[model samples]
Target: MSMLGVAAVIGVTIATFTTCGVGLAHGTGTWCALPLVWFIGFPLAITNALIVGLPLAFLFCKLRLTRWWQFAVTGFICATPVWMELAEPFTSVRWAQFGLYDSLNCFGSGLAGGLAYWWISQKVGIRRGTDEIAP
Candidate 1:
């Protein structure tokens, strides 16, 4: 359950971030590749998500912070600085093309990830015992 939840969350997060990037590029009059870029990027981002998010999740688990808020806050905070780093290489004009929406996208993605995590865990019956007699 938790595993699926994490997978879904990471899936959505990567999609959202990559879309945001493409959208920003397009908004700024850049030659943004839509379908082609998504085709290439999603898999790579998913790999990164598993590689990175899993360890971070494990750490959160160790800290007894596996709840939604914990994941949400952790994901948001962790993601925001990365956004800043992404902005660093771009010119001020291009960076300004995104502005607050970039941060919002990150926050929304984190929130969605957290909710998906919690929701999947609930739906998958992982916390429920297997010993109950079937009616």
Candidate 2:
């Protein structure tokens, strides 16, 4: 859970920097945008992690699918609903307004977050059976 939160922070940070880079390059006051983005993005990422990521993680562990790619794919999949909400494809008429760029942002967040969670879990020695004594 905590690792997921860390991942969320990482994802939000990456997406914010990427999205704000143009303004930053132009010397605009985009630095303030990070907090706002984090405010929105962090909760959303955490919610997704809890609502979607936890189940997927449990499934993966049960299935012995703990590979890095599997976690990455899980992250990408988990981020999909959030992307859909942000994109508003069904509610909006011209959905192209928030298309590829937004997608890349959200998906990138998911990927980064997922990988981060996996890395953190590994570093913390939280793998299945790691805590069990050898028979």
Candidate 3:
């Protein structure tokens, strides 16, 4: 896949996960619904990535961060908005809040996402007819 294509996938995935994290964090239900948000979430995720991920990728690249570190960083970066949005003081339940789980999820999601992007891009290679080339 081209960088743009890969970016699209990453963006979408990031958005989806972010939405899930935010939703799970703020939801008051016994259990969170994961599959219900795909329609709206996919586009939102991709758009978010395109809008946010591109600059992030460039920044990471510029900083000369390793791919593994980038994934960790990317996940943390992706979760920031969610964290910020859910920062309102809770008035009811205080046992388990969204912050801890959401933060962890964001970190994990970012690590996985970064690794996937790096792997896919490396596997796809830079030239046409050589997508099979392994990095």
Query: What TM-score, over all chains together, does every model reach?
Result: 0.56, 0.76, 0.54
Give the TM-score comparing model 3 with the true structure, all chains together: 0.54
Top candidate (TM-score): 2
Each candidate's number of clashing pairs is 0, 0, 2
Model 2 Cα shift for residue 84 (angstroms): 0.7
Please give me the total number of clashing residue pairs in predicted model 2. Answer: 0
Query: Which of the numbered candidates is closest to the native, going by highest lDDT?
Result: 2
Clashing pairs in 1: none
Query: Higher-TM-score candidate among 2 and 3?
Result: 2
Candidate 1 or 2, higher TM-score? Answer: 2
lDDT of 3 by residue, 4-123 (tens): 335445644664566565665667342434464356434444555556666776665555444555555674577456445544454424325444554454444445555666666556
- Better candidate by lDDT, 1 or 2: 2
TM-score-wise, the better of 1 and 3 is: 1
Give candidate 1 regions above 4 Å deviation.
1-45, 126-135
- The per-residue C-alpha lDDT of model 1 at residue 120 equals 63
Models, CA RMSD each: 6.4, 4.2, 7.1
Locate the minimum summed-lDDT window of 10 residues in model 1.
125-134
